[model samples]
Target: MKERIVVKIGSNVLTRKDGTLDVTRMSALVDQVAELHKEGIEVILVSSGAVASGKTELKIKDKLDTISARQLYSAVGQAKLINRYYDLFHQHRIVCGQVLATKEDFATRRHYLNQRNCMTVMLDNNVIPIVNENDTISVNELMFTDNDELSGLVAAMMGSHKLIILSNIDGIFDGDPNKSQSKVIREIDTQKDQIEEFIQSSKSTAGRGGMQTKYNIARKVAEEGIEVIIANGRKDNILIHLLKDKETLCTRFIPSTKGVSSVKKWIAHSEGFTKGEIHINEGAKDALLGEKAISLLPVGVTKVTGNFETDDIVRIIDESGKQIGIGRTSYNSQKANEIIGKNNKKAIIHYDYLYIEK
Candidate 1:
């Protein structure tokens, strides 16, 4: 069977050099997706360019500051961008759904699972999901940098075998794309940190993410046991060439290191937006990490924090204020509070579904 794939096309590929929507390029890509779907391969697209499209549609005159420009451009661009994509995909007889995600979407465990379930159901129904960041309401752009991390999270959520990043450049170059002697890196392994010093910081038109950011995301997604390919989207038959030919000139981040499964990685990384926290004693921390197969006794819990319901993801912190692990809580905050520092009957975090810190 063909592998499930997630393709992220950046704004530079979807927009003209002057920052207007490139309808021709968009149509061509959509047609390629339609052809790929005919082969029975599932493809989900994470697209950018709403703000750039909006800027062209709105026809704003003067140069604006960072905050004002993003707020206005995103407000103007989001609907028009989706409408264009909808029209293009409609011609290909492919149904597309819009999903606007913020940093908080994957921060909480409940919201994370809900998102995963929603995408799974959509893919099962043969509907392609077009995901983008909610730039209008997002305030974490400075910290999150760009939607590269968002694309990785979506790929991990969908358990995709491959992630193709369609950008303007050919691939990762040694010196820079503008330089004549800059060599394209065809394969990247676990020793990517060695090439970190050679990477140059360069941003593209119509988007905030640069090559450096994409490289960072590629490294991260590759670590999750997913193959990541970075290539030029403007090239003709780019998608077809990538999937069919192994000799294609692209930076391929191979999944070399093996780790826990996708579910465990998700559980381990969900630190933000946790409803509650369990401060465990040192002995309990050791037991959880070791071969104890024991339920979390109340005597092991030193304190409980935050307001959470049953089955919410909570941090397992040690007495020294260090995070020991993350696990699904079996009881609410109030219930766990009552059982703290006592020999309780119920386990706060059961043995099953409980992941200890490594």
Candidate 2:
């Protein structure tokens, strides 16, 4: 099988100091991707620059609201951005397709499968799929955390072997990147690494996601058995060096050896789309989190909160109301409430459908 990789280029990487699209930088990045593509590597690019691209051509005379401004800018910008990608990839004789997605697309099984199939067909036809959030329609609360979150979903959905997040800075620093003493941590063991204390909570001036968001998405993707790299996109030929020369300037996330099934990987990223909550007793919580793989039976369910139908994703809570995991329920909310603490009832969630947060 060919090695499939997902490269996420952030807004800061593609925009100039004057808040305009940096055409020179965009061409440079595409050149590196072309190098990898020529080596028979399957690459999916998750790029961000549409809003900044729109800013160059249009000056808002009338004051617009935040969401309106974003919609207006991105609506105009996505077209310009995708066209640039088309011309750039055309230079390399590569056919690239645009895939704009919103959060709601991944809300159900059918939509998720459709998205996966579309990208699969694109790759099968030797077409590079350039994915980005549909910022024009993805307004306010419905939007992704940023392209960082979107890139992770794309990586998992495509079953990519690696996910590379290109940012303005070098990588996750031991301290603040602005300070001279701060240094990038070389590698992260996703299995037991703890770097939260070092992760700063600062949003980028050029994009929605901060280093914290990148770290979170990286961890989640790494847990799903994909190696993740966070590197400075400002540097020349970084992508080529990372894959070809095995460069070490970035922070690399070591993938987990305990791989999950395709269904579980999707379930892990579907936390946002869950429909209801299932509160279980201490014994149930312990058993689920324990070494033994067991299904969630109604015998341990103390309370069923909200409403959800069969096959709907539900949040699993413990006695103290902390969310321990999520799973697809086998019964509807009404059925679940009636079967609470019943010994002979069917499993509320089978082991296969459950995703426990370790």
Candidate 3:
């Protein structure tokens, strides 16, 4: 099997000190991707440089709202961005396609599968797919946390063997980057609980994600049996070194041996898009969270809130309204409410469709 890898270029890595797009850096990264292409490695590039590209040439006369400015900038920048990629790949005698995605694209099973098929066909034809968020159309509260989150989704959806998140800094550190005592943590095994304390929550104004989001996305992607690497893209030939060298200065998240089902993987990323809430009793919560896989029965459901249709995504909550997981519901909100707290009924969410927090 051709090793499929997803590479996410962060805004910090693609943006120069002047906050403009770094054309030289961008070309260098594409060169490495082309190198990987020659070796028959299927690559998906999730890039973030549209806003910076917009800053390079355009100047707005009137002050605009944050969303409006972003929309305007993305509209102009995405065009220039893809054209550059198209030209660069063409120079290498490689064909590359652009895929602009929104959060809604992965909200449902059908949409998710449709995208997966499109990219699968592209890979089968040996075409590199350069993906980016549709920032021009994405609405507030509906947008992704950042491209890091998007890359993780794409990696899982495509069943990629590895996910490489490139940023400006080296990787997660024991202390602040400015401090002399800080050092890059080389490898992250299954000790995610111990690593949580090191992730700082401060976000960046440019890309909306920081080290914390990268770590969260890395952890989630690794849990899905995909190895994840967080490395400094500013360093020349970083991607090439990661594959060639035995030791690279990157934070590697070791993947889990257990495999996750396709439907469940889609459900895992649908936590933010659930249409309704299914509040279950303590018994059902315990059973679902237990080692043995258990379906969510209607008898354990105390309440069904919101207006969702059959097969829609729904969130499973505990008595205190804490989210336990998300799943594809077998019943609509009306029917689910009708059968709540009853016995010998059909499951509200089957085990196959349920994705619980680990």
Candidate 4:
């Protein structure tokens, strides 16, 4: 069956060797995606290259040090980038919508759902949605440096079956890409701990994001049961090769053993995390996990730390302060403090709002 997919193309693949927009390559990619759409697959693209494309158009040679200069470049480049995509996709008679998002959008539940709605509406109308980080107005701390991370979140939000990241390299290497002995890892499986050692960090001049960021996002999305493939974008017909022929030399991260449903996966890896915590005794912890219900009774409550409001995501800790799980709270910090250590009237956290850690 045709599946929903999120494709992330990095700046290195979108720009020429001299930091110019590679129009030929961009057109080729859009063509492949258009073909996929014809096959009935829901395609969403997370693209990066606004700054680089802008730098080339304006002929600005001086280094942009200050945040303002970077924003100015992004402001100019983002328009040019989207315009190019608009022209390219139009050739295939495919309508596409542009969505520029910042970290703040995903940080709140309301904005997250709003963004989801916009994407859904576009897709429902048979229009492809092209997403990019709002770099022009977003500060460094509040920005997503790369499209790799953005693609993962979008995949999880749209309940996409797979996330395909296109970079300059073939795939994840065992060691540094510069090292001759580094070997490309074909597949990653149930072992998250074991794979950490092989992960290496490196940055791209054309883009601020690196290999490590891709690996981190891929791992997180894979945990949500969405397969993630990090492959080369520069290769001809690369997008079609992956979906049609599966003929790419990419690092494919498989799903974990404990398969989770799409809705459950979203709840487990919700965007905003709570700063508060609630500690439970061993008996309560087991009951929450085994029974899978929410009102955490005072009988299991051992301690409460941090101030959190109702519906906030809070960590569920054990008596010794180990985090056993995470769940949305049913009450505020003051109310939790009032009920902790006693079988009071309120259940601090109800069962349906909880996600016990595995």
TM-score for each predicted model, relative to the true structure: 0.76, 0.98, 0.97, 0.85
Which one wins on lDDT? Answer: 2
Please identify model 4 stretches exceeding 4 Å from their true place.
59-65, 191-193, 256-263, 271-307, 315-326, 344-347, 355-357
Tens digit of lDDT per residue, candidate 4, span 234-260? 999998889876646788889765556
- lDDT score at residue 131, model 1, on the 0-100 scale: 89
lDDT of each: 0.81, 0.93, 0.90, 0.81
lDDT score, residue 152, model 4? Answer: 82
* lDDT: the better of candidates 3 and 4: 3
lDDT string, candidate 2, 96-121, tens digits? 99999999888777899999999999
Candidate 3: worst 10 consecutive residues by lDDT? 190-199
State the lDDT of candidate 3 residue by residue for 24-104, as single tens digits: 999999999999999989999999999888767787898999999899889999999999999999999999999999999
Tell me which of candidates 1 and 2 scores higher on lDDT: 2
Off by over 4 Å in 3: none
Location of the lowest summed lDDT over 10 successive residues in candidate 1: 139-148
